[model samples]
Target chain A: MKLLLLSNSAAPGRSYLDHAREVIAEHLDGVTELLFVPYALADHDGYTAKVAAFMDTLGIRVRGAHTAREPRELVASAQAVFIGGGNSFRLLKSLQRHGLVDAVARRIRADGVPYMGSSAGTNMACPTLRTTNDMPIVQPVSFDTLGLVPFQINPHYLDPVPGSAHMGETREERLRQLLEENDVPVLGLREGTWLRRSHDALELGGLAAGARLFTSGAEPVEHAPGADLSPLLAAEARFDCRPD
Target chain B: MKLLLLSNSAAPGRSYLDHAREVIAEHLDGVTELLFVPYALADHDGYTAKVAAFMDTLGIRVRGAHTAREPRELVASAQAVFIGGGNSFRLLKSLQRHGLVDAVARRIRADGVPYMGSSAGTNMACPTLRTTNDMPIVQPVSFDTLGLVPFQINPHYLDPVPGSAHMGETREERLRQLLEENDVPVLGLREGTWLRRSHDALELGGLAAGARLFTSGAEPVEHAPGADLSPLLAAEARFDCRPD
Candidate 1:
């Protein structure tokens, strides 16, 4: 299976999908058409139009999964499947409502169709959507998502603002709590960075600096852009706490 | 009913519960014993001990609901109830797990027991926990919480950091999406601020500057500290979209 899980579609001072252009082109190489899941987007048509315009630069045609009479069939037949980012909960809820979660997962994990997501889209590729930063404005039937990867993806991660008075949990603290309840490793993907998986090999890449990985028993480890993170994919679940 | 829903227990450079001393004293006046719900806290014992110490200064005895053999009975017999904040989702899930959601809500809404919550705790007093900023690390049986208030509370409300590159939705945008789906209004309680309810009157107070109120279709309006926001309580649900 191949995947391009992007932290964000756009970076500050960059045009839409500009930062991810090179990666997207390489990831979707030889794919003439792609199926776009726009459920994560609030403005579905606008998101589809913008994505289609971006994909045009790569000479690929884009179709909306929302408009398809049979979304599962669309995922099954697509050359590459892309999930655009917005609200993760809403996106997952819509996918569950449309009965496309397993279908999309099957295409990406078992059938070997290329899968790509940014922000909320990337979150969908994780074992569960528990690590998403989006508000729980809507509840999905479950937090489960595509288990394309063994771990969780926290897209658009940010370091806490120095000296800010906000008392909410930092990105690190939240992930620590997640480790308390679950054994899954969490990868904090900073904006402008992404993870690429080609078969068994996984690597972090982008114009940004690096990503932070949090496992239960160890300190959060940072890896620079283009660093190999394939070991994380194969590592057995390790817990600081005793397993249930 | 008396309620002290704080955005945060303390301000930067202040001691825990320090910023809230006077208001908390006033809110809990005439109360001898207070029941503390510390489930939102990752360290329940640490939280309870600190809270008990803080209440000792106010000449009040604090009991931990987590250690109680009968949490519902504790809620029923308490002169006041306080839910400390850590994770709103965890707090709600614990209350639901212990069958204390309705008991606590009934105490505040009907039995006239004084209720106080900070951060996640403040979020619980709202119509729903949908507006919380906490990560959904765990799924509650439902997003429903103690509906002691007509509107929702977005504790630790912050404006977008100027010139920051984070592409995720701002607090305002998240609330906008919430309004899209739910008709309830949202009160953005910035850190160090809170809304006090004494019977039918609701007033915004604390050291922080002001609170932002979001209703469907209308621009968010700011309310200064000590603003008599009782009208918000009596106002019938207004929606930019058709009401459900």
Candidate 2:
């Protein structure tokens, strides 16, 4: 399967998708048209239009899956798929309601279609949406997602601020609590980072600030931009509890 | 009904329960013993013991609900109930699993048992756990919480950092997104602040940092300490979607 899972769409000073323009272009190389899933945000047309405008600069035509009469069929016929980020719960609920979870997964894993995701969309590629930082504004049918990748992903991961007086659990603490219930590895992707999976090799790429890998009985290990994370694809996911 | 919901158990540089010692003592006036629910954290025994140590200083005997032969009976017989803070999802899951949701609610509303919650515990007093700031580390049977209060509560509410490049949604943004899905109002309780309800009166009280009240379409309004929030107790909760 081919995937480009980004941590975020924008960086500090750059416009949407501007920071990783080159990487996105290379990931969608030779592809003339791409299908965009814009269900994460409330405004589907607006989100699709924003992405289309950006993809236009890269010499590609963007079609919104929401506009398709048959979204599943659109996924099946697409040369590449891109899912933008917003609220993960809303995204998963829409995907489950539209019956596109299996359809998109089949397209990516069985048909080898290139898949790209940002923020909540990046969360969609994981086994479950359990690690997302978004609030549960709405409930999905389940925490289960595409499962295109073996482990979980915590998108937009933030390290604890030094000397902050806030008592809320830091990003690391929450992920550690997750490990107490589920024996699955979590990849905390900081902003400006993207994980590219080309066939069997998975490479972390972006500007400086890298990523952190968290496992069940160990301290989180940090990785740089060029780190090889292909081994995590073989990790087994065993959940001890379910939402229902 | 009498309730004391704290945004956090400890403020900056303060020991557990120390920041709210005077208020807690007043809230638990004439009461000698309190039943503590520690299911939010994995180590129930440790959590219960920690709360017990703090409550001892307030001249109250603390009992762990986990240690009771029948937890429901313990809730029924308690002079006051205190649910310590940890993970909201885990806390709700355990409460639902042990059949304590209804029991605790009955004690608070029907029996007038004083209910005290900190952080995740504070979230339990709301209609649902949708507004909590914690990660979905575990899935509860449902997002349904105690519903001791009419609206939702977002504990540990943090303002957006000035000029920070993080692309993740701010606390205000996430709460606004929640308004899109549910018609219920939300109370964003910042640290060093709390909500206290007695009989038919509700008041925002605690340290200097105040609270933010969020409605469906209106911009959030700020409330100072000692602000009259009794009207919110009558607000209706209408959930547009359910997890199942």
Candidate 3:
């Protein structure tokens, strides 16, 4: 299995996908066409057009899954898959509703199709959508995702603001509460950082801002770019949840 | 119906419930015993104990509903009910799992039991938990909440930071996306603000931070403390979701 899971698509001042242009190009080398899943956001055509325009500059053609008559078939025959970010619940529901969750997962595991995701797309690679920071704008069939990765991923993870007066739970506190329920590790990927998985090996790469690794009963540990995170792939995931 | 929906339980540097002590006292003027729902957080006993200790100062006796053999029956007999803050999904799931959603709603509408909620508790008063800022750490039987209010509430609503580089959805953007799917107006309550409902009357109360009101296809309008918001009680809510 090969995957490029980005924490987010854009950075502060850079254009969309500009911050990770080199990494994305290297990851999609030799791929002529990329299937784009744009169900996370409400505007499918607009989102696909934006991505298609960006990929055109790289000599790659982008086709939206929503535009296909049989999205499942598109996923099955795709050379490469790229899922963009927006709302995780909306994206998961669309994938499940269209019966493409298993198809996408099969392509990645069985056919070794290169899978790339950003933000909500990165969350889809996790065992469950339970670690997402997005609002529950919509309810999916379940919190379960593709399970492309064994552990959970909290994308665009933010640190607690210093001396802020907001009474809401910090990103870290929310992740801690998740640990209290499920026996799985969570990788809190800050913006500009990403995880690349190739079969048995996983590497953290991107800008200077690294990522935090959160495990049950242990304090979060930070890992910088170029750090090896393959050990986490071996951790077991036991979700303590019941579906109605 | 009488309700005290608080955005949060505490503010920075302030003790629990201190910010809303006077309002709480006024809301529960004639009540001697208050039933506490602590299902949002993992430590039910600890959460109940903390609220029990705080309510004791106001000459009110507090009972943990989790300790009762039949929590539904406790809601039926209670003079008032207070649900504290934590994960909204966890709170909604626990209430649904234990069959307390209808019980609490019945008490508020039929028995006129003064109802109070902080954070996740306040979110429970809405038609659904779609507007909650918390992560979807757990999937409830449904997004269907108590529906005590006709609309949704986004608690701890924060305005966009001027120059932050975080690529995650802003509080405003998330709520806007929600409007795209559902025909409902949402009340964005800031840290120190709350909504008080008494039969046909509704008012915004608390500090000067004020609150923002978001309606579909329209710009979010701001409302100051002491602003009359009863008109919103008449707005219709149509949730566009399918339960799996």
Candidate 4:
């Protein structure tokens, strides 16, 4: 029942995992090795190597699910778990293809393995991948995800740019349309921000802007950094339905 | 196969359907009554009323698919068809829900009923709705669309904004990822531009900019305004496969 959902791996001009170093360290406390899910990015080997190198700096050993004979068994016995960002649809498809969706979720919930993900990885922890901003390049068997967290996570969220000529739907409008069809709450995790879930308590963290919360029948509200976000977790209990 | 696929309904400070009035008039030549699919927008009646009022000026009568007792029958017999802009996933779901997908495609390809769509509507004309920029707020039974056109259409295409802080996938990157898993061509239609298809001929039109074509094993190529896009249609023939 522990999670560290990051909006992105790093802020602008920062190295990989630079902004999230301390948070990752704290989440992986006393852990020397972890299972890394690199299915989001297409180049499994390159992605695995890049992430493994980064984790090495944190003094943690990294093993990729791609190299495992039984990815589920690796997740079950891992000291910690992390999923990197790329295409959410691709990641979900791989998870379903490898039959690891339930395994990853069980490891995080029942086994209490510390789960960490960024971008598409963060989206994997949600009730459904419906709130993802990634293009539907591939269709997963279902939009369902791990449900490690009760609410949805929109990673790398951004407000509309001012005076811009682009006419595509803004991030907020997209989430609003999702709310019309789905009753679950959505956390708009701006870059450098993340949600920390521990048992019954959830909190927002990081610098820069606060997280934007989109709940049904309400205007989106902002939660300051380091603020307790357990209310959204509780609100998830009130709504018993998940998007089909 | 007659089609008018627009990148957007209107540009900044322009009336609804204003920029494409002449093209729409030319495409709908000799047609008095046309079928309007307004399921993309949430307010069906409001969307129908607004579009009806606008068509009144062009001396054309509009019938909404929403009010029809048999939506598929209406699509089959319509003199022409038009779908407005909104969430692509929602529109695709409604099309599948009311069983209008095949009917609309048959009307356009077999019956030669002129098909006109903006934004989500344009995406529907493609083989698959994968290239759509709209959020996947709703998961359609499938991403398959009408297949009226051989390639995918990315409406409202824009390059990365200069000095912008947004880290979401760029239009080109999203399309590139699509090409990774798909071999079909993708046309990035900038705002104010559209594709005009008549039988076997295809062309680009409008004021803003050229259309960017993303094909397999090639960097994106720009087609100047008013250029004949018939080559792409022929290439579609050589491939002999449609996106699933």
Candidate 5:
């Protein structure tokens, strides 16, 4: 069982969601039961209904993952577990508040659930949620999440804005700083792109995309999707999840 | 005295130190006794040499502001402060390790020193350094920074790689998160762009290039050099920097 991560909720007239849907249909054709998390949708106008309707169109019924006693049972028994996107912080907060963080982590690691995450959904798989560029809608206190994936996922990456005075750091520059401070690989994924990691190697999964693997001594290499990522993923897994 | 911030070092073939020349010549036409900070220089391959060369390139001689026994004296005696760009994390860490955080903050606010920052230099002006996308080569344990600017800055606006699968939040999505979390304004500057904040107000500055500002309940607006940012800057100053 794998969790499919969607960066945003699938709804009417949004092209980005459609790309996510296509990836699900192609990779998870036979899977049926899925737990949908539209945590970012709590306040959006009509967003909840829109997500429900969108799942209906995809032939996958969406429900709150924590609605049941053992959501992992549903996840483990299902053909696939899909985590829809919204706000990374909100969804993570909801998970932490519900005490489902550990449950979700156990499911993804032990239950063989195929986890596909997009955007916010994708963000939860990392070791810490701090890597997200999303506004800190909710501070989780602890950045611990599913940890199915070790590296930070930078989705829909766009370069820094030009010729203006607003200064913090460029997205790439920030990620570069993260890379230098910690030995982790931050995959900068654009829309309609994803990485599939099997064991010690990672492979670019979706549309043509470039990813950067940051490590010590070696210059970060920008590679396109469909390239092997297993080596990177496997190598990074050696580091324990214990907080520094 | 004012602080001048630069986004990155400088365009290729144009040494960042040379940028200092232009700034001193144009911005500080009548000023003397300047201070320079190369925080991001920690990650550069040859930052020390670069800094030395940049200092040498100046027709007039200046002293390193870092030499002061206290951050206050360093900032107080200077006609203006200049921060050179490199890696934000390294620069911030150096400041923190040297215990210059509050010193820099006091100099900027209490002392009323005119300050300018560019590239990584500009990144340090925000109250919290979390907005920077630079990889954390060094962690200062606190995001609190010089509060010279309220909003986060995205410098060196570049585009996503053409045709890539690493899809997720595009650069705009990242800024959206910043805006959602920050009721304050966010400025995205291209190379050679800048914003000036004085008297609790922010105004677009220099660079014929473009800049973008993101705020709540409104669309992003473009800013040209010398545009008024008082309203934006004032509201941001009111925002709570403390996380919930």
Candidate 6:
């Protein structure tokens, strides 16, 4: 199974076009069951509609794409689940009430369904949804989600805050505290960059910008992010994001 | 299954203690399996010790507790799990790499084990961790987590940001976006406050500092948030917390 995680909704990296293309490729080009979760998609109304248009453009078959109506049924026939980005919290909670979580999990475990997510969708792959750095107004029961991917992903990685005296714990400090207490690798994906997991490892994808990989076992590494993705043409094959 | 989620490590909620006591007295007490996951126990070396002491004082036997060590076996054995808070990201990744992901799922599913998470721990109980206002420096591979609770938990609830050009997203905005995206409720769990889910409904806990509950299907309602936790107490259950 292959899963794609994007940090945001706007254009892959900069504003949204590339992200759109990535979704098409992940869902239409080489998969069977397609599931798109747009928690953050709410911020931009055009998100789901635009994706609907894109599905038509690519001629990809979508068994389930929304959480508002007939929610759990959508995941029943899906071979690929695509979760678009917007707000991670809202997206997840929507998935919960509609009772589609089990459907997604079953698809992943029993069917080896191909999974694709961007922004908020990508965030859902981690152990907890707290790493998304999105606002916290909405509350779902848990930050836990589909464990298709292994690393906690930061889609839009920005530089450290400028100046001193902000006093509040800086984002880096918070993450550092996380690292100090835990034993997993942290990946900082810049705009236009993505992470792909299949088989047995995690690999960086997307060429729009550079990506940084951080792990408890070693120092941080930076890379250009992705390949042509032509290597993943086969639909049934599995991909792992870990380094070889 | 009886679960207890705490806010911060600083103090155990009076209401939380009360409810736990009551649950133990009615059906758990001696038969309960007590497991403490200090997955976020970093920064202060005293954190873990403090937790240990608290358990000792409560007269609860620490069947097992984990600091840096993976607790797969312990998680598997426990009838209930209490995850403490430190950093949301840290706690999350620990849960992920330790293979606690599947273990937690099993406990919740087959065993119907009670799951309690606080602060960082509380953040992990949601569907997605995006509800937290914590900074994103440390990144975990995926946003997957234990789905014991079904609401976005915003620990340390506070008033609006007075005024600032912080550049980075504000805490309120983070919470707002989380709520806007999905249909689940957001629990604005101020320090000393908590939400409890029993059978099929949710109960607000903590009087010293009351918590607020937000749902996409309904407007946000404040659970009692105050200093006096006596009203929220359950009775006769032993518990513990430590600062490492």
Question: Local distance difference test, per candidate?
Answer: 0.86, 0.89, 0.91, 0.85, 0.60, 0.58
- lDDT sort, best first: 3, 2, 1, 4, 5, 6
Using alpha carbons, what is the TM-score of model 1? 0.95
- Look at candidate 1 and give me any clashing residue pairs: none
Rank by TM-score (best first):
3, 2, 4, 1, 5, 6
Note the residue pairs that clash in candidate 2.
none
Please list the residue runs of candidate 4 whose C-alpha ends up more than 4 Å from where it truly belongs after superposition. A237-244, B236-244
i-RMS for every candidate (Å) is 3.7, 1.1, 1.1, 3.6, 6.2, 9.8
- Rank ordering of all candidates by DockQ, starting from the highest: 3, 2, 4, 1, 6, 5
Prediction-by-prediction clash tally: 0, 0, 0, 0, 94, 119
Give each model a TM-score: 0.95, 0.96, 0.97, 0.95, 0.70, 0.50
Tens-place lDDT digits, model 2, residues A117-189? 9999999999988899989888787889999899999988899999877777889999999988889999999
* Model 3: per-residue Cα lDDT at residue A71: 96
Q: Say which prediction, candidate 1 or candidate 6, comes out ahead on TM-score.
A: 1
- Which of 1 and 3 is ahead in lDDT? 3
lDDT of 3 by residue, B1-244 (tens): 9999999888777799888999999999989999999999999999999998889989999999899888998998999999999998888888997899999999999989999999999999999888998888777888998888899999998999987766667899999888877889999998899999999999999989899999987888999999999999998888763232
lDDT of 4 by residue, A46-80 (tens): 98888888889989989999897778878878999
Tens digit per residue, CA lDDT, model 3, A1-244: 9999999998888888988999899899999999999999999999999999889989999999998878998997899999999988889989998998999999999999999999999999999999998888877778889999999999998999998766678999999988877889999999899999999999999978899999988989999999999999998988763232
- Two-chain complex of model 6, DockQ on C-alpha atoms against the true structure: 0.17
lDDT of 4: 0.85
The all-Cα superposition gives candidate 4 an RMSD in Å to the true structure of: 2.7
Clashing pairs in 4: none
Cα deviation of B234 in candidate 1 (Å)?
3.9
lDDT of 1 by residue, A1-39 (tens): 999999998878878898889889999999999999998
Evaluating just chain A, the predictions reach TM-scores of 0.95, 0.97, 0.97, 0.95, 0.80, 0.76
Model 2, A18: alpha-carbon shift in Å? Answer: 1.4
Residue A183 of model 4 has an lDDT of 80
DockQ of each: 0.51, 0.74, 0.74, 0.51, 0.13, 0.17
Clashing pairs in 3: none
DockQ winner between 4 and 6, please give it. Answer: 4
